[model samples]
Structure formats: structure tokens, C-alpha cells
Target: MDQETAMRLLLKGATAFFLDVPSGMEFGIDMMSWATGDKFKGIKMIPQGIHFIYYSATDKYGNTAPRCGFFHNFKKSECLVRKWDPDKEELLNVPREEIAQYKTNILNLDQFLAPYPFEEQTKWNGLSSLLTENVITTLCPETTIIRSAMELFPASKTENVKRRRKWGPIRTDDDVGYDHLPNLVPKAESQFRFTEPPECHYPPGSSLSQITKHSLDSSYILEKMAEKHHNVIDLLAELQFCYICFLVGLNYESFERWKKLFQLYCMGKDAVAQNQGLYVKFLLAVRQQLDTVPEDFLVDIVENNNVIYNGLKELFRTLESGDFVLGDDLKDVTVQLRRFLQQKFGWEFNGLDEDDDDEAPVIINFDEN
Candidate 1:
């Protein structure tokens, strides 16, 4: 290439960190900050503005893979090359596409493709790789299954297959007035659900105000589950997603009751964006709490996010067992939590033994931050 052409190319591209990262993110001078801690090394600018990054760490383990998170911009503008000099402590730029097929190396591609299981990865980063790496397309095995389940069946036989069907009028269990609810909505068939707790010995510990409120709320979730189950029988008309709806009902029934009292479990899905952000943050914090939590953190199912916390426990167990289980039941997810609590917070709470397991489903929630 001509000198001017080479110079332009080199300037737009430069290595900012030794570790792999997303392409298309303008490292500017903040390349080191973009990478995870400890992996960063240094960068250099080749002639024509091209820059190469160097790292002290290498594949000593014969790590046949390169780990990277590319900072890709969907905007199709060709990026300017860049440079970083330790002496000047600044980043410089060169013309676009300075390096030839930068993402082609097999190792780099593998790292880019490895973060997630085959599920959503395809629709996200994996799809992007389609342009550069053809070998990764082998995921079609699972893709075919998903395709058949989501689309193919529906297209060919709508009557026989149904997952998206809506059923049962939405009833308000929160403080809202049931009378004011849409006239067609289903009414609560019974004020309470379930008989006396199975003959299990009662758990020790009286209710803290928080736990009390949670217990009450959990009782409601259990009631709802039972109601959902019965309603299925009445709506007897049938729905394509009947099995899925029944699954939800079973989970509700499993939530028998709790020792603590709880308030109505109410969270509205307002169309407002600000409210949405708060909800998202609340859910994330809830998940984080579950990750490293005390056994007693479970104030009650109603007060906390049972769906996700239960999911995490099940995931932990699944991981421990080294068997990947695709599931939706929340309570069953407790298989791992039992062991986790026993190990991490062995305060020795009693009622969790056979009596409780036979009497009713256990309710757990992570402690507040």
C-alpha cells in the first residue's frame, strides 16, 4: 500500500489492551479501563496508523482459546485506527480497517463465542459472528429444535399446537377492589387455600415485622396457585397452553403457607420508562442478594422474588450435578439451596426436615442489603 494510505489505515486502529475486547469500541485512551482487571498489558502503533497490543500474559496453559469482548458499534461507519504510547500516556488514531480480518483467528473467535449457553447467544453475539466465522454455525442442531417448537409447528398446524393462548380473566389480588375489576374477570372461589399445614413440626423463630408481612403475602401466592389450578378445571373449555398454565398453578399450590405474615404481593407494570427502570433495578438487586445470601435471608416467598431466587438455587444444583436441566418450576429449584444453606449458614433451623417437606412447600427469600 502507498505511504499515505498506510498511514491513514494505521491511525484508525490500535491495540489498547493485551486481552481481547469488543471490536468497534473506540478505545481512545481508556483501553485499559475497558478490559477486565489484571489482563491489560500495552499497545503499539505500526506504520500506516495500525496499532498492536502486547500483553505479558500468554497461553502458558496451552489455552487454545482467546477471550475477548468486542466493543462493536452497530453504526456502520468505518472506525479510525488508534495508538497508545506509554511515554506520552495518550491514544492516537489511524484510518479504518487497519488490520486484515482482525476477528479471523480461531482462538479469538472461540472466546467471543463462549460466554453463554446456546440459548439466546444465537440471537445476540452469535448471530453477528455469522459474517466472520462459519464454523460456529453448527449450532443448527438446537436451532432446529427451537425453530420447530416456535414457528414450524404453528405454521403447519395451528389447531393442534398452542403456547401463546390467553385464558382466565385477570383478577386483582392486590389492595385494588375486586368488584371494580372488569366484569368478566374471574372471582376468588375461596378466601383461603389449603388445609392445615401437613403434620410437620412448626419452624422456630417468631415473626419480625418484615417476616410477618412476607408470610401473609406468601400465603396469598399459594392461594393464587390453587385458584389457578381450579380455574383450569372450570374453564374446562381447554387452551393450547393448558399444560403451561397448569404448571403455574402447581407452583402456586406448592407455596402452601409461611410462618411469617405478609401483605398483598403487588407490583404494577406501568408503561412508564422510569418505573420500568426501578423495576429492573429492583429485580437485579434481588438476584444479587440471592447469589451470596444467609439462610435466614428468606424472609418469605411473598416479600421477595421467589421466581428468580428459586431459579438460581436450581441452577446452582444443576451446576453442582453437572447436568443441565431446562425447567420452569420455581419451588423445585430449592434442591441446591438446601445444601447451600446447610454449608453457608448452618444456623440449624429445624422445621426444614421431613415434616415440613411433607406438610408444605418451603418458602425462602434473600435478606435485604
Candidate 2:
């Protein structure tokens, strides 16, 4: 490291003191992780910004627990302290007094802490730049914990009893069926509070023609979803939030939500021209997001009819058409994104064949009035 860089880190970098964590457990900040050793306390020289801290406990037999993590925005030269609860196999907050004491004795404790891997910072920023403090606070569970495997609770007694009565008594292996299994649901407080997509794609009391248009385009649904946010940018922030949760926190549910949001953005042609600034930002966000996705995942996407390719094809077609007079900024970002996809994934936007059945427009015949 350069002397100036080291000095800057010493003055501004934050520290995380993880106390009494067992050896052989997996611990990480951002995109990197390690199987911790006996001397490992936590990470130091952490850049002051939003980051994810994750860990998993491992048993003596080498079986690792499900991953758990939280997002925290570190302040300049801050000291954060957490203690491991061996019995619970979870990280818990230390008392204010203990945290203060830890900060006071940080110099003596520094030797046990590892420096943050600065090399990964740029990659992390690419994935997380759009995420704001508000986004994390809004979307994360009330407990501020994200678990790879969701914690579930047994269904309510009334509902379970109703199902049991319908299924009747079972005697043997053959009798065991889906209805006989207990209904499990995620705990309310522990579930991510993602903004729910509009239940109905079209507006209430819309004409059949209007309904068909809305169904095909989803611009109305996108507009309704934006109404829930303070502004369009917050919607984009939620998009970023969902991606990070899926990518870094290893949450599959968040991945599903990300797909929903991505689809909404892609299908909203009218909304793009209406919210030009948002689409420009949206394209940039998409570009950054694709960089973080693994090549294997892209292969799976390509095999599954390639929703991303189809979506972008429609979007680029709309921009090229003479219907909308798009701003130069939007046009520039769109060009950059097209070039990026071409270089990164061999995805060509120009001269694309319109062979997809999904692209066919819906036609509704209204009764003559």
C-alpha cells in the first residue's frame, strides 16, 4: 500500500470488533469471506460507506450453518462492536458501555483485526452505489437481519385445523400428501418489507381496449408502484436493495422480487418517455447490476427464453422508433448500455429478429356502442 493511502485509511477507516467469535466460522465483509482463525477478532480499516457484514457458524464436523448478514453505514473512524452468542449461534450487540470501552482500547486490540480488502471496494460500489440509507431501512427486516434460509413459523391454528379436517385422517406412507403437510409461513417481523406490486395491471373501470394495452405494457402498474415511493429514484434504490440482498446476502426471495421490478421497468414503454431521467438512471443501474451477475446465471437466463434479452430488445426498439423524442442523455446511456451488453455478454441490440410470441400485441374487439 502507498504511504499516503495507509495514512488516509488510518485517519478515516472504520473498524468492526467481533468479540468471542469461534474459529472455523465463516466471516465476511462485502463480497469476500474467510474461514476465520483463532486470532481473528474482526475487520479494520473499513472504508466509510454502506457495507454488508455476514457470517455462518460451523460445527466441529464442518457442517456450516445458513448465512446471516446485515447492512450498516459506517461513519468515519467509527468503532462498531458485536459479541457472539455461542448458544444461539448469532452475533449480538454489546452494551453501550462495552462498545465505548472497546473503542477506547482499540489501539491494543488492533493486532487481532484484519484490514478490509480494498481491492474489492470498486466491485462492491458498482453493486451498491444506488442503495441509500433509506432503502436499507425500508426494505430490510425489522430485526435488521437477512438470512439465506428464511425462518418460518407454523401456520395459524385455525388455518391448520381447517386443512387437517379437509384432508381427514392418514394411516400410512401412501396417505401422506401435500395437504397433510403443515403449512409454514415466514415470521412477519423477520420478512423483508418489499413494496408489493400492483395486484391488477389495469386501472379500475378501464375500457377493454385500455385494459389490453395496460396488460401488454405494464406502464400503469409501474406508475402505481412509483406512487408508493417518495420519488422515482427511491424505486430504483429498492431495485438496488433487492439485487444486493440476493447477490451478497444470498436471499432467493429477494432475487424473485428483483425479477419482478426488472420486468416492470422493462415493460413500461410509456413510463420511459414520461420519466426520462428515471430511465437513464435505470439503464445505468441495470448495466452495473449485470456486471455483478455470474456468467453461469446468465447462461441459465439465456436458456429460459432470455427474458433480459427480450426486455432490452423491446426497450431498444421503442427508443429507435420515431414514436418518442428521447433526450440526448437517455439516448447516450442507452447506447452505452447496448455497447456494454454486446462486449460483456455478446448480446447484440441491432438487427434483432422479432421472433418472440410474447412481443405480439394484444388486440381487443369492443362492441359497437
Candidate 3:
């Protein structure tokens, strides 16, 4: 708008000059995909935060490899330059002097490079917030570059039967037949994996048998989940990261991985019953994240039997059952979530039965966030 503000943004935003990017291939940061034209460089006023840059390289025969992307935490006014390696088919960082020169000449270069799509910034923020710099650094141990992070597994016939050609207009995955295709498996051994791999993130080797009714305390359980970490913030970040990696990133392994963890806590009937304190804290964290999940992401989940949704639904049902009991804090979080889901998504939850003549349930309120 104003000169001063424009100058500030120019100083704050980062520049990405990718040289020799192949024509006909798609490149983009976050939500915006760019089909490179004559002047193929990309310049944008990127917010100083963690972002994902991805591309799909295509050949003449219409065949393509798995979608490749990388995560970066940009600093204020950071200038990044990369040259495409035709052999590796990846972007390699340019030399320091070259980057310095590019930064100096950015005013002239602005004419050629495309501006960031401001209209898509809202959607980009929603997606990018799911993964933070710490979370990315922790989850992507082998490589932050997703192409290298992807593990190839043999696909099954069942997978082939259920697989669709397109999940959305954007081709997040390569169009290869599942039977003949290799899986784009996310690494479970990485820092993002549930402490109990393929299940809940309870302390290592801890189980329901070890957890007793007397030992149940929401704060204590949260501490256990966090362990040495200051708080459960890291755990929450991981949950959000895994979910996005699965849903938007088109990593099936990540979906299954997130589901396993989600099901472990939300759907673990005996586990939840025995450890209601832990269950409540977990749900609180999940409720906080629910707002961040976009409607499209939810639609994708709903199309796939709504595993997370159903799990939470079942948890609510269990909590309302006569046999189950919850602390005031847990009950407050559950009720708030139930009300929110009902208003937002038309999900209905039945409270204690009408026939049962009992004292009115006490209502305790907690911060939604």
C-alpha cells in the first residue's frame, strides 16, 4: 500500500531464485503451484516461518515420479538460490557469492520473478501451521527433502482396487497403478513416530496394566507423555505434523501412522477407561488442533470412513455411558468439543440417558484453547 510498508515487506520477505528449472514441470511453495514460463524464477514476500516447497517433475511420456518437497524455516529477508540438477532432478543450493549478488540485484530481478500469490496465503497458513520448524527438524531426520525421505514399498492388489486416479484436481501423487507401484512410505523410526510405534505415545513400554485408577491425573499423564520435554507442546506439534503429512502431503504411510496413534488414544476403550486423565489431556490437545484442520482435509477423512471423527465420537459415547466417569476438567473439554462439533459439523452427541433418574451433571467450563 504505502512506500514505507512496501519497503518493509521487501526487507522482510525472502527470495527464491531457482535456475534452470525444467519446463513443463510444476514448482511451488505451500499452496501455490507455478507452471514455469519464459522467466522461470520465483520471488515472493514469504512470511518468516516454516514452509514446504514441492515440485512434480514430468517426462514426455506422461510418467512422473513421486511428488517431491522440502521444508524450510525462512528468516527475515533471507535470500535463497538453487540450481536444478538435471541428473539428480533436485534443486541444489547456489553458492554464497551468487546469492549475495542476487539479493543486491533483486530490484531489477523483480521484473522477471513471479510474486507470491497473496490470495492463497490464508490456505497456506492453515496448512503450514500444522508443521513447525522444531517438528520438521525432528520428523525429517534422514532428509528434509521429501523425495529422499520417501521409502518405497511393494503395493498390494487390495490397494490397487481401492485406489482412485485423483484425490483432487492437484496431482499430489504420481499416476502409477498401485499393483505396479511402490509405496511412498514415511519413516516410522524418525523422531515423529509414536513412542510406542504404531500406537499411542504413552511412555516407552507403558500400558493399561501399569496405569491404575488411583494413579490417574491429567497433569501427571501429560508430563509422562512429554517425559523430559518441557511440556506436551512437542507432542502436539508432532500430531499436527503427522496428520498434515498424511492428508495434504499425500503420504499414505503418514495417514496410517497418524490413525494408529489417534486410534490408540481415542479408540482405546480399555486404555481410556483405565486412564481417563491421560485421555482428557490428549483430547484437549486434539480439540485445539481441530480448528487448524481445514474442511477439505476433513472431507477427505470423512470419505475414508472418518476414522478420527468416529474415534472421537466413540470416545464421547464411552464418556457418556453410565459405567464411565470423567474428572471435571476432562468432562468440560469433552462437552465443549461435543458442542463445537455439533454446531460446526452437525455431529450430535447424546448425553446421559433420559430414563435414568440422576442428579443433573455438573457443568465445568475450560478455555477452548
Best by TM-score: 2
Model 2 root mean square deviation, Cα atoms: 5.2
Candidate 3 all-Cα RMSD: 10.5
lDDT tens readout by residue for model 3, 1-369: 687876677767987788888777877776678777767877667778877778777777857666777778888889989888888887888889999999898888776677666787776665455456766776764556654246545445444343433332322335444333444433433323343331233345556765432132222333455553334556555666666665446565565656655654554455556656666667765765576567887878777766766667656655776366667877887888888888877776555244325332222111111
Q: Using TM-score as the measure, what is the rank order of every candidate, best first? A: 2, 3, 1
TM-score of each: 0.20, 0.89, 0.65
lDDT by residue for model 2 over 32-58, one digit each (tens)? 999899999899899989999999999
lDDT of candidate 1 over 132-183, digit per residue (tens): 1111121112221111011222122232122113333544446276423333
Ranking by lDDT: 2, 3, 1
Against the true structure, what is every candidate's RMSD?
21.8, 5.2, 10.5
Residue 336, candidate 2: alpha-carbon lDDT: 93
**Candidate number that wins on lDDT, 1 or 2:** 2
Kindly give the stretch of ten consecutive residues in candidate 3 with the minimal lDDT sum. Answer: 360-369
Error of 2 at 11 (Å): 3.2
